[model samples]
Target chain A: MSVGASINARGLTKSYGSGEGAFHALGPIDLDIKPGEFVSLIGPSGCGKSTTMLLVSGLEPPSAGSIAIDGRPLTKPITEIGIVFQDHLLLEFRTAMKNVLLQQEIRGLDRAESRQRAEHLFARLGLVGAEDRYPWQLSGGMRQRVSIARALVHDPSMLLMDEPFGALDAISRTQIRHDLEMLWLETRKTVLFITHSIDEAIGLSDRVFVMSRSPGRIVDEIKIDLPRPRPAHLGEYPDFAAYTKRIYSVFEKLGVYKFD
Target chain B: MSDQIAPVTSPPTPAARLIRAGWLWSILNSVLSVVIFLALWEGLIRLFDVPVWLVPKPSDFLGRFLVDYPEILRNALATSVTLAAGFGLGVVIAVPLALLMVSIGALERGLYPVIVFLNIMPKTVIGPILIIWFGVSPLVSVLVVFLMCFFPVLVDSMHGFRAVDPRLDYITRSMGATPWQAFRYVRLPASMSHIFAGMRIGIVKAVEGVIIAEFIGSSAGLGFMIMRASSFMNMELLFCGLVAVAIVALIFNALLATSERIMMPWVRPR
Candidate 1:
């Protein structure tokens, strides 16, 4: 298992175009995620949480600011990481197993070892018997699981998920959230999970950073003291409810919800 | 719930049975319709005492088809060669050209309007020009066919390449995929169905092109044979050539469909 790398961002910002037509997507925000920590960037639509995740992964260069991974400045894309998008994004031509093995194929990892890891991941993600099936053959949730398996198959030190379960049905989302939490507990890879769901952020993250809408910056950060493998009925816990209320209040204060 | 429903192991339902036997039924239906139409044509021609020069009876056409089998086969071989050569060249050139144009924005900008202008000009018009330039040779027919086959494949290929979801690039990039790896693993495979679709259209256009080219300038081919038969007023031979061209087109389409199924097994019906 690869040990997680600490992700540090200083004054990270992203802008599209320039001058009069410029769109400020993200902020001159500073973020520090400890190694092995599971952090969630929770925000509303267009809050730039996704931008922050992309910048951290170094998939896109920040318009301005700096990012360092494991104390090393990220000059190019950080390849030692797995990313999951809301869309399953499985290569339709590849089988569910082959989709996961794509990482190994591209990265030139040990084929035998990677295949074994993929099989293990398949089982863990409840994707057994689905290895040979194409993406079109799988359910929404099952497809998402395959993508998650692909992310973990390479055993990257960090995982970046941008609303990985956003497209799933409610029940599937709950089940997958539970499964993801279990996997994270086992691997303990530094996770930067971006989501709009407060419950999901609070349910899974070690720390949740709440951001305001558009030109999004972290407005508040809340640390969850919830127990490991958190209870399904998180609303029952006073502490959990308090965390939820705190995040909701932050959003409310930002005028996300308005009452006349 | 999985995208596919559970496989039916019990007795097949009425709908399931119909679907299971659908292809066979459709083939039988088409054959029956053709037979009925032919029977009607044969009867009407005989009753009217129609001259063979005007319109040969189905019997005479089939008779001429067998009697002149060697000659018809020779001409068909010529046409097939032209079709294959032209279509093959078109695919080889158009697909790569499309990839280049799509990969390079400047190339797309510089070349797309020129391509559109060329495609807008009628292929039949190009046939005479090609003949004038290349003389009465097989190369003229092949070049005409190439012009007809190139545009659709190029346009559709560009469309396919552009249609790839941007997020897929992000996923592949995170996997340490180089630009070439990303294209090979993602873009190329993703664009395959579209490429095949373009090839299908291109092949049909190629058939039209080859025949027109042969009509204009070719010394041989089914089109050339038809022109020759018409000059001699041998309607039977003319009909035979027409049927041969139709059969050849059908065979080409069937080959294309089969290869498409083989190449894209994921799209195969369960």
Candidate 2:
């Protein structure tokens, strides 16, 4: 039996409070993500990108919208979705290996299998020696690596990353981006990454969804026809610059970016 | 570039080394001062022709206690047992009460004023009432000790639980952790320092509690021994009793400090 999954959202409206104190953070909009697609949501701060990711990950319920993952309505527990927040969010007391193994505990996988999977992922992510160390002992980049390893340990078909590398230095961010794209290419798991950087959206995404501020809605979707196993130097390419420029123009037109 | 490549392991600076050595020297100095104090005390008693009942020298106090060592030991054991029981009871009550305060805002609001009122009310004033109700028994002494030491533990634990990082709580909840799981994993671990802080204070207060209990109601502990010595104007025995209580309190505090170091090894030293 094949366990195939795709995420679908329609008329997804989220409003905080009611009556005189009503506030709409996100859409009465619709979104559909096909299986094995890398989609990036790019917008200004407070544009509800994080909220959208939360809603899609089944972490929060939509007020009016319905979400169906793998054609099944997302009412019950979802075992095949992994989420990464801006902070690595690893349990400080647990070792990096144990942190990765937590996904296995959550998914109710066997201990031996979980350990094997965690070890394999840790090694694959260049975290071999750091496995026994606690989160506090590791650097920021290493902690983020642990988070990615944790997300992949359960072999989740869908990965939701909310600015996963946003807190890192420029060098670490670029390196992680390269590694992430490589991982995505190898695994072909459906990924929804949210970011504020147009360059990042263009660099890593197969398709970028540009969102507007206030009541967040997808203003435009730009397809990047970038080839597989994307080179680190791809950012220097005219085509990549053109895609970023176009996205920036859309932000500028939406008055979200004031490009002086 | 060569300097950068070389792994340079620097030794402690002379100033830092001096400071580290200074602590040991100061401790030695303190011991010397204490010895001088006792010798002077013994000499003054001998020279001034002080009465044995009023101020028996350190030697006399030590000689008498050593000969009657078994009796003193028995009383010490009784005092220790009562102290341990009272301390244990206070811990058992305080931890859950702190957790309750942390969990229920309404309950905390309702109880805060009462706790504040009770904490300020003199334990000495309550002593007579407790003895009257429970009688002059070991049980009453233990109960007195418990009452005296309970609030510090409760207040400290409540502060610790409340002090957990809100961001960490948010992270745990977003990870699909249940409420109990969040408390167990995040809140409880984060509150450990605060709990330990309360425990350290509680232990010292527990010693005070035992003495207070013994003074007012019980007849078998150091407090009662001191009271008896005072009645007969036996200042040396009274001083001996006081010293014994100080030693016990110091030992308890040291144990707590050691345990805190073991439990929270990651906590940066001030």
Candidate 3:
């Protein structure tokens, strides 16, 4: 069993260029995630949700603040992490199996163990026969599933998913949401999922952080107290509707939804 | 349910069969068209009683091909060897140089403009200049072919390497991939389809370059044979030389297409 790492950030900010021309992308924000917790950042475009994920992954340096993973100040891209992007970001050349194995190949992990784990993940993700297919051969939904398997193959301590199901069809979105929740129930990896879907943010996450537009800051944090295995029709759950309404009101206040 | 199963169990439909046999069918179609064209040419030439010096009949070149088989074979072989050498060298040099240039911003900024300037100038003009520099040797022919191919391969390869989505780099870096590992696993494979596209253009240019070089400097090769045949008014031999060059170019293209399929199987129609 793999224990998840807690994520900590203080005054995390990112700005591109300099002086009068500088574009402030994110932050002067603070975030703390407990071990094995599921959290989501929901906001409009340009809210720096993706930027926040990038900084936490340490793929890019923050202009002004600091991040600590498992209480260690991060100076480099952390290895014990999996990242999924909206584009699926799969290498078109490799088969689905090889793409999943790439994590093991890069990390120099035990080959047989990684292969076994990858096979298990494939089975769990409903990707049994898709291991040999290239990204182009698979449907949009199957491709996303393969990407998810790749993210989890190495059993990372933290999973950072940025709109993993945004491009998927409605059915795939629902199915993958359920599958992701079930997987989280099993591994309990610390997850920081970013999305524009309010229902998704509330349904999958233990806590949802609503962010403001442009120089984004976490405007509100809503903890969902709903029962586990959240119902497919989230509208049936009174608390789910309350959570949705609360996030909507934050967006409305931020001028995302305007009424004359 | 029975209707759905019936379709699966039945023989393949005509459209499916045609698509499955598409490659062979296309080749046969091309062969048929060429044969018809040759028959028309042979008939017209015989009807007009035209002199062979003016334009040899298809049969006339066919006869020439049979009688001068050894000579044509030798010259064709020479041309093939020179083309292979020059094109191979160009690929070897250009791909790595493109990689280096793409990796280092300063090198790309410094060198790309000069490369573009060179590419814009006519490579044909440089054939005679190369002969003058290298003194009418096989080396001059090789150098000309190299010059012809180098630019396109380099430019397209640079484009391929730089065309990678920035998110891909982040994906690899998040996994703690070293720069070399990221390049080897991701950048190189991602660039292959583009690299092969460059090679396709390079091979065509190479065929043209070899003939130009042989036209100016070499005493051997199909180009030299064509020149010799023309001077003696042996139209049949000139036509034979031309046919040989066409076959060689086709072969190079076929080889490249096969390699592309092997290297980047994802690009093949599923």
All candidates in order of DockQ, best leading: 1, 3, 2
lDDT order of candidates, best first? 1, 3, 2
Individual DockQ of the candidates? 0.52, 0.14, 0.49
Give the range where candidate 1 chain B is weakest over 10 consecutive residues by summed lDDT: B1-10
User: TM-scores for all candidates?
Assistant: 0.95, 0.85, 0.94
Residue A185, candidate 2: how far off, in angstroms? 2.6
lDDT of 3 by residue, B145-244 (tens): 9989999899899999999998999889888899999999999999988898899999999999999889889999988889898898888899999989
Give the alpha carbon lDDT tens digit for every residue of A186-231 in model 1.
9999999999888899989999999988898989999999888987
DockQ (0 to 1) for model 3: 0.49
| lDDT, candidate 1, at A43 | 88
Model 3: residues >4 Å from true position, as ranges? Answer: B1-30
**How well is each residue in A1-260 modelled by candidate 3, as lDDT tens digits?**
67799999999999999999999999989999999999999999988999999999998899999999999998889888889989898999888899999999998999999999999998888887777777777778777888989899999999999999999877778888988898999999999999999989988999999999999999999998888888677898878778988988999999988967
Where does candidate 2 stray beyond 4 Å? A1-4, A76-79, A105-108, B1-60, B165-181, B261-270
Interface RMSD of 3: 6.9
Candidates sorted by TM-score, descending order?
1, 3, 2
* Cα distance off (Å), candidate 2, residue A227: 1.7
Chain A TM-score per candidate? 0.98, 0.95, 0.98
RMSD of each: 3.3, 5.3, 3.8
Q: Candidate 2 residues A1-260, lDDT tens each?
A: 12225779998889889999999999876888888889999899998899888788776788888999888898744557677888998876577888888666644578898798788777667787777676776788888889999878777788889999899887778778888888777788989999977767888888899999979998999998888667767766779888878888888899987867
The top-ranked prediction according to TM-score is: 1
Better of 1 and 3 by DockQ: 1
